[model samples]
Target: MNEYSLLVLATQYSFTAAFAAMAAGTLYFMMERNNLTPEYSPVASLCAMVSLVAAINYFVMKDTVGLDGQAASLAGFATDYRYIDWLITTPLLLAVLPVLLGRSRMNNGMMARLLAVDVLMIVVGYIGEVSINRAGGGTMTGWWCLLISMACWFYILYVLFAEIGRALEGADSYLKSSLGFLRTYLVISWVVYPLGYLIAVLDLSDNLLIGREMVYCIADVIAKVGFGMAAVSVAKRLSAMQWEARS
Candidate 1:
């Protein structure tokens, strides 16, 4: 009926979903590490790492789910742990791009720059979110941090698409094709974060909180587990090709 109730329900569901992601990630990592090639271990492990991070976040946020006004205010209305999760996991997710594309193609300098920007995006975004709780000039600081974070995000996308274009152009057919889907997936899946950010910050309605948690839960599953599978697919294809050439 109200936003609080909705958020309470959403939070319960999120716990289940987050746990599932972590379990799936664990299974994936074990299978890949034992059965798949060494090249895929990093991808599998990173996937597991992000899923585990999400799991931790859901646990951290459990305390604030359905409290009333005074209780909620005392408990802190926002879940800063989500941003901390993002800070750790996002760069790991992005690292997949270079791993798949080959470092020479992505280049060490560009990769470092991308990671730095990614860190900035999460850190600034967290600062912005927390600043909303401050008194006096807090609102303005929050907006500024958010704006800077968004700029950093857009810049990262620019590097992924515009700068990486040349490298993709020269990639083999399999890599080109697989990476095409990956690029599209990254763009689409990432759009969910800003929407989550808006909802989480504005606290527009209880439904918005519900929407935010659900979106984040679904997005994590897709971004981490789904993308990990994609990397595995590419690695498998490459392995198969190598075998064929040798045979």
Candidate 2:
């Protein structure tokens, strides 16, 4: 097959794998939600909903990139779908972090601030990517948006590591451990996004575009499925602890 065809196939398979991973995790969490602690039911449900969004996003994303392995025309809904997915799923994923942190610890104001940062990060990211690919607005505009998004990202990491990390010191040991896993997960797995943006958005070459999509697909599976599975484990542990206390 030609290089373009190969790239298309790779993208198709990669996103398909992501969809499967997310969808499977969704089902698993939903099925087991009843057995979890009452507090954890919402966590399980949110995991399922987030994965469902990923699964749907993958199917829609297939059309965003043409068979030539480049981003398709922006005129169609397909090109805009990525932003839509982020609009929905990004907040959900961020919400999971604070929920796990516990409302009493995080407080409403802190949650709102964190979520505002998350929204800005995603929105700026979307603007950067769409401007690069669709706006005909030149690379500088997109780069500027990307730079702003990066600043927001650094702020988020600071909160997680410096602020929340400090707060976790007096928390339940199990919660501290689980939140640690989440912090590590965000740093290690979510970092792929900016890297992918640099790869595809900077150059916009066909090959580089394909590479970007593949990178994103891989990151999606690892972040969503991996994060959800890890959360499930934490929920299970929390449920056991709660059960022990009651018994």
Candidate 3:
């Protein structure tokens, strides 16, 4: 890569690292604010922390990874992506499981159904990723993974928006705030992955040259930052609400 390309990569890494730190902090605060009963808090926090750690590791090691060829250091990228997916989605599934199983008293049938759908979507995503990795030619299987990821993202956004609407209906400030943050975060964060896939699929590198790699890096950074911000915003909102109720 040229000097400009190298600079772009460095910038991207910095952005991603910053976001990872923010995510970790956000999750820590969330656990404390929500009073997430030891059982759920640890898992949720683990999700955020793992994501943060993976991002940082990727950022640090990005320079060492080759991205010039078809067989470029894909293993490192795949490993990081897998870690992120597992961390982010697994805890979310855990949180939703209770609602789906009818163990929670919150009693929103629609939300429960949405959670179930989210779980299914995540499952599909994992399968798609596995298929892509095994196929290795980045053809049908890669497209399938990209498509499934987009589908799942849209559904998740729908769920967040629906929750926010419901919270508004009840005038529940905390829930509304939480949902709003989630909506913003999801929308922004999810954009990166799709964009990266699009760039790859379209073969935009022909025109952009090494700049294309920078695009992927930038996308990763944006997504991580959005996630971190959303987590922190939700945690703060919940904490304030709890304090208000107590007073």
lDDT of 2 by residue, 137-231 (tens): 34887889888989988888887788888777789988998889888896799898888777646575665665666777788888777888888
Worst 10 residues of 1 by lDDT: 66-75
Using lDDT as the measure, the top candidate is: 2
Query: How far does residue 196 in candidate 3 sit from its true spot (Å)?
Result: 1.1
Candidate ranking (lDDT, best to worst): 2, 1, 3
Highest TM-score model number: 2
Q: lDDT of all predictions, in order shown?
A: 0.70, 0.75, 0.50
Error of 3 at 55 (Å): 4.7
Which 10-residue window of candidate 3 scores lowest in summed lDDT? 96-105
lDDT of 1 by residue, 1-247 (tens): 3234545565556656666676677577657754444654566667667767766676566455533422233234355777787889889888877777865676888889999999999999888777764542337777787789889988988988877777787679888878778878887888888777676456466455555666777787787778777777776676667667779
Backbone N/Cα/C clashes per model: 1, 0, 0
Stretches > 4 Å off in candidate 2? 1-4, 63-77, 135-138
**Candidate 2 versus the native: TM-score?**
0.88
